[model samples]
Target: MAELRRENQKTTSELKETQKRLRQLTQTIRELEEENSILRAQALKLKEDTANRDLSFSRELQQMKEQLQEKSCHVSLSSYTHATVPTPTLSPAAKPPTPPDPGNSPIPQPSPTSPTLTPRDSPSDTHSLPAAQPLNTEPNPDRPAKPEAQVVLLMDSNGKYLDTKRLFPGLITRAKRCQNRGQAMELLRQDTLGNPQHIVVHTGTNDLHTLHRETAEAMTKMAKRASREFPDSRVVISTLLPRTDTPPHVIHEINMEISRSCAALPNIHLAHHTNIGTWDLHDGLHLNKVGVRAFAKTLKDVTLDRNPNSLAHTAAPPRNYRPPRYQQERQSNTASHLPAAPRPPAACYTLPSCPTQPQKTPPPSPMDDLRLCDEQSHPSPTH
Candidate 1:
């Protein structure tokens, strides 16, 4: 009985100890949870603070930017206001008297004592005033003539494709657009503006598909008429540019016809754009930026009459002639060990009136094997 009592007492003590530990653990858990809640609130507040700081900073930056822009605008406005002051106009009475011409004979001087007459003196004094000479309407031959303007005639674009004026500042560019050669001729006829130093006609690209031979004839006639109309100025007939839609041979034929016809006229010169290729054009018809730049340069050259020897008259090879890449390939394929064939001498196209002297051909090298292939491909023209 005694042992059983002791055991029961020990069991009760262990249960008490376990209960005390459980209560302590509960308190610790509650404290941890409170601390966690506080930490969460603090984190949330910190995030909000960060967000507000960023937003405020952005707003401040935006305000600064706006202020800077306003300052710049104000500065520009002030500068413009200060720079463009209106010039005061002088009335006729305020204008200084014209200096007497030395060429005219001097009037006899009145006696110094002769009543020092004022304009308010009398109508009789007005008679002593020299009679006003009638204004001369005729142009003075002695005066230096004003610089002549240059005119460029386009088909559809109104010469917007190329700005010749921007390229050549000295030149006064007058741009006019026409539909075709006929319309161009009519427009030229209607233009009452006095003769320009240079008249560059860049039309007929629009007419290639519609009219073949007639386009050439019309362009030739237009050139003739322009020459007649602008006898003092040089009439530059720009050959038809190559287009993707039209066969090159057709364009070549028309250009050849124009060349033959215009060759007789001394004042007429052809601006050959033979170097232009399909790569230069955009949309297969119109010139892109690159082409426009080149076209503008060519116009300037022709207008200034520079590079007279560079004018290309022939449609075929010789002027600006470059050997085909196939020739090099053929040479490589046929004889790898042998030296490449000597290239033909380069030549510039000249007018028939001033033909370029023939250049002697270099001796054939082992690469001449490609010449056989070339001859088969491009036979020499018969005279």
Candidate 2:
């Protein structure tokens, strides 16, 4: 009974020890959760601070950029002002004029901010400044520019030259008043014709009234000569604008000749007469503003296209329109290039005009006729 009582007391003490250990473990878990919550709060606060710092830094950078732009603008304005100020071109004998008294003069005394330009400067020098440009001197970064096309245009008075501006940019005009295909042909014979990328021959309308076919042939010849003169330049021939003097059939025939002649020429382009519509006319030949517009539009289409290899040139037809002198010279040149042929012997020819001189033929006269009659009357005495 004594041993059983001791065993019960030992079991009671062991249960009390286990209960104390369980309470201590619960208190340690509660402390760990409080520490975890505090760490999470600190991490969120750090992220917010980083975001705020980035925003403030970005604002400061933008402000700095604005300030730099303002400074650059001011510098450019000052430089432009200095460049435009007239530099006095004074002669050795010229003296500076005396300044007026500030108190006596009605005009206010000049401020000392900037030096005044002198009146002694010549008008030419003042007008022709070194670098006079607008105040905003900085070139635009976004502007994509191209060099202007430099072209020389030769046209007759009937040509509406202003209409060409719509298509031909940077055009230099050489318009002749009261000119025909013949006159335009004469201009091509000049020795020094400048080399241009585009050479426009807008003529033949004046001569199309009576010489429509001939004028068309002459125009083709003109295109050939222009090509020869400016070997590097492409000759663009604009067709005769709408005119009442020539029938549509004549116009069609002329256009056909132009196409045929210009086909072989690699540089020649024919601007066909298109129905860009018609304009009113008094003499049935002169092209008014509307007719000119139509012609210019046709020209625009021709120039935009670079290929002109389809047009074939007729060797014999184009030659007909060439000047007589040119034809003779060409013949001589061709003959010179040929193989030398044997000449006829001097002894073989008997005529006076031959290589060997001979007797001259007598001239017939009325005196010879009277002598013949006398001989007949005296024939009986002689017998």
Candidate 3:
């Protein structure tokens, strides 16, 4: 009976231990489930943040594109006006009217015996004139007159022999055909009589296939001569437009040479439409409608901006005008009698001026010098 009781006690202990282990495992599983829920919530929040950032960036890009379009539209409007308007034409009949003479006798003059009309017995009375009469209807000279500026000649070489009358219509007053450079030069020389203030050189399309180094050189020389003859005139050198059917590389090479040549000249300006690649070359060389419009707009802007007469009307300083700092300093010094601070000494030694030193004559050399000296000392044949 005592042995049976001890076995029952041992079995009861084993049952209690198994039940404690099961409770501990249940608590661990519950903690693990809470952590998993927190991780899922964080993952969902991160995805939402990423999506919001992308949306905001897309909206900003769209806004920038809209602004660019608006600016381009505004520029197009101004460009259209400039291209369509023709330059003012002057007539020979627009001469200034002569002024009426004030001494004409239309009304009766006062009697010489009258107190107001009587001349004083003085030296000033010797040159006195009769009383003025009402003048007849005549033109007045004091009226404000329009000041005449110079006329500029703009030529567009559309790569053809078409007459200027056909190409430009009413824009050009006089147009002449010239087959070669010599003929062109002759025409230019004659145009000087009209005193052209600007010359636009548009050439090289016809000579593209036949172009050589000499062609560019000749063109450059002609431009330089034009500048010299018409010192007041501005010469513009435009790059050749690309041809649609021809290879782009050939056109590119020609343009490159043109650009290089233009850069060497001071008075010549390079007008390039393809620098920014705004328009596409549809036919390879000739511009489409859009390209032509863009080209004309660029020309108008550059012409107006650089024209001396245009700047005069606006009362704006010339674009290239910049006063030297030394001039400013000189003016200030003159006004205030304040001298500028002396510059610091240079780091290297400088050679001193030896103006007073008599240039020494070196002893005669073994060859020419000695022979020439000996010949000078001893008389030789006169011949």
> What TM-score does each of the candidates earn?
0.42, 0.40, 0.33
**Residue lDDT tens for model 2, 1-383:** 99998898888888788888888888888998899899899988998999999999999999999999999998877566444333545556655567678889998766999677676754645543345444444555555664333465667765645545556755654434437777666766434234557767777777776674697678788888877776766678887665544455676778788888878887888787555323334345665565565556656668667543423421122222333343457679989999778888987886666476787989868999999898888875543
Off by over 4 Å in 1: 1-155, 308-383
- lDDT of each structure? 0.73, 0.66, 0.56
Model 2 reaches what TM-score against the true structure?
A: 0.40
RMSD of 2: 21.8
The alpha-carbon lDDT assigned to residue 263 of candidate 1 equals 91
- Write the residue-wise lDDT of candidate 3 on 105-207 in tens digits: 5765667776563346555544433344453233345545543223343344443333334333434334334444554565566344355444555555555
Better of 1 and 2 by lDDT: 1
Candidate 1: deviation at residue 246, Å? 0.7
User: What lDDT score is found at residue 300 in candidate 1?
Assistant: 72
What is the alpha-carbon lDDT for the whole of candidate 1?
A: 0.73
Q: Write the per-residue lDDT of candidate 1 for residues 213-306, one digit (tens) a residue.
A: 6888888888898888878887788888877667667888999999999998868888878766656666767777867876776777887878
Candidate 2: segments with Cα more than 4 A from true spot:
1-88, 91-149, 163-166, 170-178, 209-212, 276-283, 306-383
- Highest lDDT scorer: 1
lDDT of 1 at 127: 51
